[model samples]
Every structure is written in structure tokens, then in C-alpha cells.
Target: MKKPAKILTTAMIMLFSLVQMPLTQAAMITTGEAIQAQQRNIDRDNLLSMLQKDELRAQLAAYGVDAQAAAERISHMTDAEIAMLNDHLDEMPAGESFLSVIGLIVVVLVVTDLIGATDVFPFIRPVS
Candidate 1:
């Protein structure tokens, strides 16, 4: 009986010590920062979704731009770079010229298009 009690007590003490240890290292995260990061991810995803469009993908293929490389590049870009690229995209209006826009978006965002802003283009609908 004493031997069983000693073994049980030792097990309980070990379990108690384990429980007393920190479960996980807590990291500080502000709500605003989290929301901003999430928004960036969504925006990046939207741009990637745009790339997946058949017309755009073919256009990219025609231009010899590798779609996979472009996506990988987005992951390494800084927040400011992403914001800048997104701002450019927001300026573009989806229209009959969507193919051209897609080409330019891929080219411009990836630093290969080297063209002027699209907002000034006659076809682009003003952000309303």
C-alpha cells in the first residue's frame, strides 16, 4: 500500500510540475496590425486570383512571363511594395480591355511592364 501511494504521489508531482510550466510562449499582437496583415494577405490573394483568370494567364504565357515566379515574388515583397502595387491595381477598371489590363498588371507589378499609370487611360473607369 505504501509503495503504491509513493508511486502515485511521484506521478502526481511530476504531472503537477508539467502543468505549472508555461503552455506556450505568448507573443504580443495588436488587433490593428493583425487586421492590416490579414488585409494584405487578402489583397495579395485577390491579385493572385486575378492571375489565375484564363485570359490573363494566357496573356502572361504569350509574354513569356512565368506565373509561378510572379507569385513567389509577391511573398518576398515588403508591405510598402505590396501597398504600392495594390494601389496601382485599384486604379485599374475591369472592362473590355481587361486582357490588356491583366498584361499590364503582371508586367507592371513584377517590374517588367515599365508603363505609365492606367488611371489616366481613357478606358479606365474612375473609382466611384
Candidate 2:
């Protein structure tokens, strides 16, 4: 009788251990899942930077947005705002054009000297 009771207790312990194994695995969160969750947080922060620009915030308010709610909605904004920001930058004047204007002035002066408008350059003697 004692030998049979000891065997039965040992079998029950083994079965319990087997049942707990699956539960432990189910409760475990994978490292990849944790990294993905962190990445999502970083993405949300980037979205907020775009949506929280002063000009963009004012534009949203003009469209009847609640300022506080606008901040909350940043995480949900689509790529449309990014597209609009890109378009806005495209519409700005190019800084290099100002330098081009100066070059044009120098070319005009050289052409005028060649045509005898003024004998400003000693190398170019006027027709006299």
C-alpha cells in the first residue's frame, strides 16, 4: 500500500508541473514584441514634433480644432500633414537666386564696357 501511494503522489506532481509549463510560456512576453512597442513610442514622439509646430498648431485651431485635443490627436494624424509641410517648404523662395542676381549685374557691366557704354576698364580703350 505504501509503495502504491508514493507512486501516485509522484505522478500527480509531474502532471501539475506539465500543466504549469504552458501557462508560464503563455505569460512570457518576447523581446521582439517589447522592442516593437518601444519603436511605436518613438514614432508617436516624431509625429508630435510635426503636429506641434507653432504654425501647424495655429492652422489646426483655425480649422475649429481644440488646442488640447489637437495635441492628443497627433498620434493619430496621417501622412497628410507631412505632405503639406513638404509642399509648404517647396513654395518658399530659393536663397541661391539672390546670388544669381549679383552675377547677372556683373555680366551686364562687362557687356556695357565692351559696347563702349563706359570706359570703366582700362584694358578696353573706347572708340573715341
Candidate 3:
């Protein structure tokens, strides 16, 4: 190739390479948001831990939800969902029925799906 053509080809290749590279940017977050995020993560971990406990898992099985499948499903919950659930856990009164809480969570997930926040189940119709 001629000199000008060679330079143009090189320039085009460089431009395309730059376009193909990913760009990263960081935005400032409020302290409250940061705390909320951390709490959400903690909540998610605690919930997953509870689900994985053998005794609790056996109860979940009795409720007709497979332990592993329930754990996997919980893994897909959004941060807000997790935080809301965590708040519920934190506020649970002593001696309240624990199995009901798990069942209520399943119901809430189904309701969340109906509200279009998630598409985890196929049987429910999501609200528009």
C-alpha cells in the first residue's frame, strides 16, 4: 500500500480499537445509600445462610420448596427486595411462627413477580 493509504488504515484500526474498549466511570454516592447497600448485602447473606441450614431446609422441603432451588431463587432477588426482607427479619417478634415467615416470603416473591419487579415464576401474570 502507498504511504497515505497505510497511515489511513492504521488510523482507522486505532479508532476502531478505541471504540471497542470499555469505558468506566465512578459516581458519588450518599452515605445513606452506601449503608443501605451494605445492609442489603448482609441481609442477602443472612437469608441465604438461613435457607442453607439443614433444619430450616428440611422445613422448606416440607413446604414444597426444594432447599437448593429456594437458595438459587433468593440469589436472584434485587437489593431492595432483599433489604425489605431483612427489615422483616430484624423486626420479627420472639416466638412468632418461623415457617410462616418463609411461606410469607414465597408469597411476597410471587406478588413481586405479579407487580413486574421480577419474572421468576411463569404461572403468574405480570402487571403492566
Candidate 4:
């Protein structure tokens, strides 16, 4: 009984010695910044969701732009750029002004293609 008790005590001491507490870090984030981050995430989701629509995909295809590629590029865009885009989208008048939105899509595609970020149009050779 003494031997068994000694062995158990030794084992527990070794186990406790080997155990380590996890290190944690905490940082203060301003309320405005947190709100901005959440809004940015929501805006990005909305844009990505918009890109998922079949009609939008068809329209993009008609302009020689790949919807998947557009989504990929959008994923790489900065938070500020995404916010700007979302703001523009929100400002667009509803109903008959959809052509303007299409125009906007084409322009964005062309610009990205020209900038070498995308290869949607064959005519525009991205800057080397």
C-alpha cells in the first residue's frame, strides 16, 4: 500500500509538472471600428450573393466576363473598395434603371481586365 501510494503521488506530480496554462491575448477595439467591420462583412456578403444570381451570371457572360472570376476578384478587394461598391449599389434607383447597373458591371469588368486583375475580354491586353 505504501509503494502504490508513493507511485501514484509521483505520477501526479510528473503530470502536473508537464501541464501548461494556455496564453491568451486581449486587445481593445473601438465600437466604431467594430461596427465598421461588421458592416463591411455584411456588404461583402450582399455583393457575393448578388453575384450568385443566374440572371446576373447570364448578363456577365454576355459581356464576356466570368461570374466566378468576378467573385474571386471581389473577394480580393479591400474593405474600403467593397464599401464604396455597396454604397453605389444602394444608391441605384430601382426598376427601369437596371441598364445603368449593367453598364456599371461592364465598366468594372473592363477596368479590372485592363488592370491585369482579370482576363475577361480578349481585346484588352492587361498592362504588362
Predicted structure with the largest TM-score when compared to the true one: 4
- Once model 1 is optimally superposed onto the true structure by TM-score, how far is the C-alpha of residue 67 displaced, in angstroms? 1.3
By descending lDDT, how would the candidates be arranged? Answer: 4, 3, 1, 2
What candidate 3 gets wrong by more than 4 Å, as runs, is 1-23, 112-128
Model 2 C-alpha lDDT per residue in residues 1-128, reported as the tens digit of each score: 99999999999999999987754444677999798667666655654565556655565555444445544543443455334333444455776432332233234334545767643345765554
> Model 1 over residues 42-70: C-alpha lDDT tens digits?
88887677766787778767766666655
Q: Can you rank all candidates by TM-score, best first?
A: 4, 3, 1, 2
lDDT of 4: 0.79
Error of 3 at 88 (Å): 1.9
Instruction: Point out where model 1 deviates above 4 Å.
Output: 1-27, 96-128
lDDT of 3 at 92: 77
Q: State the lDDT of candidate 3 residue by residue for 51-105, as single tens digits.
A: 7677777777676666676677678888877777777776878565366667766
Question: What's the CA error at residue 76 for candidate 4, in Å?
Answer: 1.2
RMSD versus native structure for model 3: 4.3
Point out where model 2 deviates above 4 Å.
Answer: 23-42, 74-128
Candidate with more favorable, higher lDDT: 1 or 4: 4
lDDT of 1 at 105: 52
Q: Candidate 1 local accuracy as lDDT? A: 0.67
Candidate 2 global lDDT? 0.52
